[model samples]
Target chain A: MKAACVENGLVLVRELPDPEPGKGQALVRTHSCGLCASDAHFISGGQNVIDLSRKMGGPYAALHYERAFVPGHEFVGEVLDYGPDSRRSVKTGRRVTSVPIMRQGGTHAVVGFSHECPGGCGELMLLDEDFLLEIPEGLPDDHAAMIEPLAVGLEHARRGRPEKGDAALVLGCGAIGLGVIAGLAMMGVGPIVAADFYADRRDLALKAGAHIAIDPRETDPYGPLPDFGGRRVNLIYENVGVPGMLQRIVEAAPFDGRIVMGGYCMEQEALFVFAAQNKRLNIQFAGGEEPQDMDLALRSIADGRLDVTPWLGGRVGLGGVADAIANLSGPGTPVRTVVDPRLL
Target chain B: MKAACVENGLVLVRELPDPEPGKGQALVRTHSCGLCASDAHFISGGQNVIDLSRKMGGPYAALHYERAFVPGHEFVGEVLDYGPDSRRSVKTGRRVTSVPIMRQGGTHAVVGFSHECPGGCGELMLLDEDFLLEIPEGLPDDHAAMIEPLAVGLEHARRGRPEKGDAALVLGCGAIGLGVIAGLAMMGVGPIVAADFYADRRDLALKAGAHIAIDPRETDPYGPLPDFGGRRVNLIYENVGVPGMLQRIVEAAPFDGRIVMGGYCMEQEALFVFAAQNKRLNIQFAGGEEPQDMDLALRSIADGRLDVTPWLGGRVGLGGVADAIANLSGPGTPVRTVVDPRLL
Candidate 1:
């Protein structure tokens, strides 16, 4: 199987043996996968992440820094075969997308991040049979691949717990931020304001249902919005993952503001606890996609209720994975750059 | 009126004019006031707090850095008189306690910190008539003075939202942390553990209803507890207001832990947002006492459901206010020092 593998902190295209399906696992032919910002972070700071996780006794302590792994979690594929003792609910050749977790006996590995389980960047991947969700008939493979990130947004929105008449401000307009905007918009949370440095991302934010899009350099995202009659932003979605961004948000958030942190900052950040305490702020650090969130995201996309077509950017093949990951951090980056294993 | 006032960044015992009752205000003769840690913070870094508040556009922007102010908020007093347009619900000479907020027309000031609103550290102070709660019969003046701090703990507990079978870890065993233990015990939350450097404070925590008290130097506060069948501490109350305590708590807290920050860290602090995000932690910055919390605290003391007599420490007069304030940050500090202006 040809794949883009992350080895020695560098991504390289190489031919690797096809992954065999274990018990309760199903083999799938890679259809399409999204190039995620997390993949970029893993490529740059995977060792640091592993070290920190080890220090904290977290789940990532099991990951070895020197091991090569395939990096793609937001993916959709067609089922090919199932291992023994699998549930086999979804028929072979059916398009499906799971939560990207593979259960192997007493332990589990996230399909994309572990060397034992290859991801959709490769020609073949394995998924937990019980966790698979069959893609609906009319849903495009690209959109199905997006369910993971959109599910992330749904989870973030749910964690934010937006109420009636609550104004939401998204701190970034990347794929995760746009998904948060779409989720907030779908949930009828209004007057959503999205901020980004690039004008193109800001435009994409507006297209993705942000009522207001502003370049943060020229405008304050936390300022009183005219759309809500000068109501301050009470709910903030922090998708900007930088060293000082959390502290900046804490200072800028209004009294009693609730913040949902969706961005994964691989570096250390600082916060002034006194300021947060004085404002009586509530901060919820949001995690990955859940089954219900994935279900809602897929249903929202399939029903045409969410127009994610604008979020889809240029497509790449296995060889372009490194460039796609690099492009994510550069100026005028697209909301999502997808990878199709056979594109080359 | 003779009072210990914060003047030019120094505590000076000087003769000052007695505070006059304004509209909807009641003049109260100082009975007893509990010296709080916040008073210590204010004395040392009042200017910095004011500057930060001004930068954040907080309510403290109106405070003047050079002005003399009284530093006491946890107080119980006897009503002397009521001003014009005051509610005057409580009869003259009745013992009372309020939420420490003095309403002046459209503007409001926290009683102890504002120069115009002298607090219970003075010979006489004024409080908003509407905010006063009558100290019940048989409640000692010292016990009544503690209602404010206990109310703070109740508010912190409410913000923590403890559930049945939840393990609670208090980071500091000061008066505020002891109050939290009492609040948790009163609410029937079980298996409370408190940590502090001072053995006396730890003993106070036990008296206030902590099931276990451990010296943080000898034992890890967040480690598995023996009482709850090795359940990890999922709920944390942070009362150690220091620069790096927040980050340390974030790192030590278990996955999906709920942290209620009752400590007011006046200094700028740093946090690793990635660590918090990876653990999916919820951090709630608890503010001061609310009316309902005050009522609960008063009722709990009056009914004998909560015993706070153990918290009352040495009593001081107006002349000793400076030493009492200085002692707060030193070793072997008492849970609380009471200031009785009439004693001298």
Candidate 2:
């Protein structure tokens, strides 16, 4: 099996030995895997300038606790084999997507994902039968690969409790930001304003059903996004954790507005506080996407409640690696990218 | 009548002509008045250091608009006379306490507190018919003088909705802090922990029904205050808007705890924002005592539900001019001070 491996400051496709199904586990043959900004955090000398202290919780327990570990958790695959004692929740050859979060760190999973002990991302993966949610009959592989991130957006939307007729502002049109916009749209929460600093991301936000795409680079988004609400936006889905970004969103929020912070903090430069005091805001944190949240996200996709297609800016295989990472990390990357591991 | 007027860095007890009742107003002969810390802001020139260009609304409005305006606004007095055409709502000769906050800048007020539309501290204050609350019989004039500042505590307690069985921390034992503790005690909110820099202030807070007095200058308060709630204080009545005081309260607050900012924000500070995020804090800016809120405070006092005796640290008069201001500004000046205009 060929998989993307991080070795000596490089993320390269390499042939790796296949893994076997353990107790309550299923062997999953990879189909597609998305390169997540989070994955960039785990790989030292890889790409992103991460602090290395705030590593995300995942299925690879020992590796998560170790110095060196394989990266990439956002992926889709077909169940190839399973322990005889595994539940009927999963079937061999069934296409599915699974969440990457783990309680004690993903030590049990190697390939696909596991709802059982914990899970991980590697050449060959072991998944607990319960973690796999079958992809709908006709959904494309690229769309299926997006389930994990969509769950993040879904969590924020659920926490925000956005109702129909509620205006929303999603700060940062990064991959997670796009998911928030799409999820909020599903609830009929609108006049949605998506804010970002990059032109390409702003354009992607519009395609993702944001009624207004505010590019801070061109105009002051602080005053513009809230004009639709007759005050500030009623709900702000904060997917960017820059210091001052929260204050801006707070000021741009209406009285008694709800702000769900769904971003992984750190890295952002500007910060402010007084703006929040003046608005009397209600803020809640929405951390890593849980499996149950991912389940609902997949269900929304299946029911057409959420439309993430517009945020799918590009698709690639392992061969198009550098461009995808660069685009995702550079000045302006579109909302999302789909990577097909099988194409390699 | 004599009023101590501050001019040219000099405070003098001058023979000022007695004020007369004007239309829609009443002349109140002051019996007792509380010297608030805000007066110290100007007396010590601590306020003269900053640029007032971006000052926010309220009592501070005059500081931005006019210079050397007459300052005292908190007092208990007998209504000497109601202006001609005084409505049935207000009767002359009724012993009452009035909050000095009135509308507009550079305008006349029914109360002699023309500084903030004429607060209640002058020898004879003309008050808007709207600002008066009937003082309860048998309540000491010194105690009645504090109802205005105490109303500050009552207003925040109302906004915080600190119910019975909730933990509360009254930070900064100014008149506002004593008021906060008293109000919380009436609401059955406890076990109240009072945090202040001064021993006298902290002791006064305890006497005002705070379960414990944690002086920050003597020891770290976080450990004990949080344990009072068996987790964290459910309500924090913040009367001191120091740079990091808000942050400390936020970090020590229980999940979803409420922080009612009972003090004034003379300037913007970064501490409020940083702690707000990590704690997911909710801060309500309780501006000065409102008319209705003042009534509630007086009623509470009349019913013996609140007490401010411990804060009435000293009593002086128009002639004790320099001493009154200095006492109110010091670290060991007891808690609250009262001024008798007759002393002039």
For model 2, the interface Cα RMSD in angstroms equals: 6.7
Worst 10 residues of 2 chain B by lDDT: B49-58
lDDT of 2 by residue, B141-166 (tens): 88788778888777777777677667
TM-score each candidate.
0.91, 0.73
lDDT of 1 by residue, A127-187 (tens): 9988898999888899888888988888888888888989999988887898899889888
Best by TM-score: 1
Please provide, for model 2 over A1-344, each residue's C-alpha lDDT reduced to its tens digit, 9 standing for 90 to 100: 55555554456666665656666667777676666664553343222122221232123322332222345566677888887776757667788777653322333333322223222234456555667778877887667777888887777777677877677878888778888887777677768888887778887777767888877667655454444645346777877754466555654565556678776553432222333443445566564566777887788767776566765667776666546655566564545665666665
> For model 2, what is the error of residue B310's alpha carbon versus the real structure, in angstroms, after optimal superposition?
1.2
True contacts kept of each: 0.76, 0.08
